[model samples]
Target chain A: MSFFIAHTVHDALTALSDGARPVAGGSDLVVGARHGKAPLPPHLVAIDRIAELREVHHTDSGVIIGALVTHHDIEMHALLTTSYAGLADGSALVGSPSTRNVGTLGGNVMNASPAMDTGSPLLVLGAEVELQSLRGTRRLGIAELWTGPGRTCAEPDELCVAVHLPAPAPNSNSAYLRLEYRRAMEIAVVGAAAAVTLAADGSISAVRVALTAVAPTIIEVVGLVGGTVADVAAAAAAAASEQATPISDQRASDRYRRHTVGVMAGRAVQAAARRAGGEMIPVPLNRAVGIGAAS
Target chain B: MAIGWWPSFSVPSGAYVKIDGDGSGQIITGAQECGTGAVMTLRQLAADEVGLRADDFELVYQDTSVAPYDMGATGSQTLFNNGRAVVAAAAQVAEQLRALAAQHLEANAADIVLADGVASVAGTPSASVTIAELAAQAAGGELLIGHGSGAPPAPPTTVGSTCVGDVGMAAWVAPQFSCHAVRVKLDRDTGVTRVLQVSAAHDSGTIINRVGAEGQVQGAVLMGIGQALTEGTTYDDQARQRNPALLEYKLQTCADAPTVDISFIEIATPDAGPRGAKGLAEAPNVATPAAISNALAQLVGHPVRRLPMTAERVWLSMQPAEPEVAG
Candidate 1:
């Protein structure tokens, strides 16, 4: 049977220091019950009741997103809209309202699926994560924390506390596009996010293309292509689908998933560049269109 | 029930009438309605016999344990076959009452006529007495009670044994077709098809209740549409179903069902059925799946065979160009 325990803790950090797993909302954890992949820790800790970790505050350095803050909260946050537009969009498409209302940001990152939506946009925003244990607290880069799907670099007793995203530069924005089948409730088969900044000389300055579900981890294609409206979309698609290893399963064949990643990557690049409107673009997911096509 | 002619009117009391001790009269069974109009037809038969108004009398159809045994109602046969028995019984009871009136009035039997539940004595309006009055005088003698049955001819000269011959329905299955029209929409990217409209035309052969016939037709259409778009227990190459959980095994939700309109053209088929009614339940849903698939083909650019044209299957059929949108 799947074991469940819920209680407020006197010392939140110490409760999890003895190999206890902390749960805010069991979205991905419960889904693993069917496959029998879930490991039931002898001791369970409920951290949502702790008032100290439930606040979202902004600082001169960056924005501090409370680990308990849900996808719904982040989607409507004004600070992230103009600065981290793609992250907000990605959060909106996580799942239906029911899943979003209960699923927390810390749980999503800790679960660490290759197909995770929030991962790519967070990566594009240059985000860092905080993990706490009885010993103390240590900050780790998002890239360093994720080892692979369902396998994180954090120790068994460690719990992710907060995620910090650095504010974007002037005249810069990002966008995310998810391709799926249905309307209200659906998982992204492939997702791509890009941020483009334009220069004063009327040419591309910076670009970043982040892709999910194409590989074992969320990928950021930095120099896949140049940041011009002409090349942004196509370039991202090619780069995202490249250097990816996916196998065929019941959902779809491996070939279709790769092709989808390429298309979405290109579309994401175009979207990010459009938002930049002539500033330094961090990353641009360029679309191929007719750039390399035979006339 | 279809009322057929009663040929065996050999008993002098073959015509019909039901007389009550009181002015009120009860219609004996001249026909069996089953679920149709048997009650109304029998009431009409009795009201005319006793000169009472049609709406004035109430009916009671007791089982064989209390009421007289009947040949049983089936085929459109109740009114024609068993009607003769009840009609003859009522007429016999009337005849017996008239005979007693003639004896009591000291008049010839021919001169005694029944009018308004009474014999017209001396052909004068004020001189009449009720049938109950005459029956009361003849109470010590035989009480008037008539009982008989009706039957079609047995095997005689020109006939052959066939399919319906065993159950007497051989000439019945003349073959028929129910027509349906459907409209649907298809999403090009995902291959998801939506049902917009469904209309059906059927012939339930002389429908007694319009509401009942239409309900059956609509129910069948909904079942067919669900089967065409989604349903069936599938197994993989290793005989394992990938969707063993209830969430994965998709069924039609209430939101998915479309509106249905059913129309009927009742052909007078007295020969086809006992009361000109034929089997309609099975025929309605028979060809619906094929019709839906044809509609989907128009929405999409190809024919969809096999059931449950799911999103994945539809996506496979309409593959993306270059596998990417922008690039």
Candidate 2:
């Protein structure tokens, strides 16, 4: 018989019920088991049947994207592309186009990987996640999403139910970049994403920069580039350089990654400035092949 | 077992180049066709000597029962070592045809020119006969077959290292050199490696088949990349490779590699054979990991010398910096 856990979610404290896991698409879980990265879970509670937990609804307050929202959904949803460009871009960059259709935002937040592509951009965009368990439900800011490598602030028995992102202003824009080894499909060596807003006079009013694959957790520079546009790149680079600590490995050195972060941050800031108020810069790869694009 | 021939010589079936009437040739050898185009190159050399095209041969190889004794398929010796054998056999056959044609045409064997499978007088056009026709007359009463054999000089006992293992071994010495360069991506957080681009420059001696030689270089590079970044066998506290399932044991994915640009330089080697060219197969693979390691050293500003640059190692490297306590 298949090792499985069956339950109906009727206001269930999702996290406590899951006891460290919530199963929707089990890509990550199954991969971890097949690789012996994590022990095989004999019991898995499938939360996908819960309609309320998988719905996307927009209201005047803000957009509440269900945790089950796939990267494919984020890339295609009109409201997400317009209001939450950073989150959409982050989701779209998770893996391949096929992975975008099956991998979920909740899984990413719960996975708690320091090199998580989506985590860094979502954090920089001021996103929040809701963790539900048997006791009740609580919302935590994306900044507090992770504690360390593969470890999050969510209690062992909590399930991340939804991702909350602030609606973008008319002058707000964002850009995401992953520095992978190859142009096709591969994991990031290091990546960086930026979100910015310009004042009425077109000077830098606010900026946010985040780096991935560079630390034990997604490193974000909260207050960045509140000055002249000419110096914003330098200021943002300095902030990221101060906060990031990379390690040398076979592929690259800590010094190279740090150097790359500065280069990437400058590039993203320039890109974000040009992209203000645009629908979204079509997740670089899958602009034409949307919703079920062949990878 | 004596053939009653002079000097106790028997019919030397020393690796005959069998040219079936259909013109398809068989190159019997013991080495696998994995990367070494020895079989094809050998066939081509035999075909050239036998007055035929290189592709008109099928190589039956990697079986000890049939192939002539080879000095193993390493050190780029496939061509100069074994190819000479087939060349000698084909040359002897060509000579036999010249002698036969000379007798039939009432001419000196030395004056007979063999071209397009026909023997004729120099500067004479009409007075020519095909070898097949000449062979037909011989086949009615007799047929001729020739033989050839050669092997590279074995290493002297003074060179090879002493064998500590059960199997007998030979000492090694460097006779060739190659250079390579690689660009890679290192994960900033987890130290994962990804190959971006590879460039190689080698002097293997003679370009027998351009595609075949490049394929060998590319295959060697692929194996080198895997050894450098992926395909590591992990051992536990008891010193065992804990991973048995192929899934956990990582292999280099096609997507994980960058396009490789290879260049082959032919250095005329005086003693290698007909034209100077030493084997470049194993040499190209040797310099790969070293080049990549040097590049990583430059990237990280430190020398991290190990088999694989795993993410765990990189993560551990990113530790709290202990200040110099007034040293």
Which of the numbered candidates is closest to the native, going by highest lDDT? 2
Candidate 1 lDDT for residue A57? 82
lDDT of 2 by residue, B1-327 (tens): 000000101111235565554335566655456657876677777766655567766677545766666566655666655666666766776677678788888788777777666678677747787766766665554454556775443433443455532122221211345678788655544344556688888766677778887887787777777666555676656876655665445556554556889887677643454345456566666777777777766666664556655543433444446221110
Residue B67 of candidate 2: its Cα lDDT? 62
DockQ of each: 0.05, 0.09
Root-mean-square deviation of Cα positions for candidate 2 versus the true structure, in angstroms: 10.7
Interface RMSD of each: 9.3, 10.0
Top model by DockQ, which number? 2
Poorest 10 consecutive residues of model 2 chain B by lDDT? B1-10
* Predicted candidate 1 versus true structure: per-residue lDDT over A202-257, tens digit per residue: 44577777778767788777666455666767767777777556655544457667
**Candidate 1: which stretches are off by over 4 Å?**
A1-10, A198-205, A273-295, B1-236, B250-296, B318-327
- Which residue runs of candidate 2 sit more than 4 Å off their true CA positions? A1-27, A44-106, A128-147, A152-166, A178-190, A214-216, A223-225, A244-267, A277-295, B1-27, B38-68, B71-73, B85-205, B216-269, B272-278, B282-327
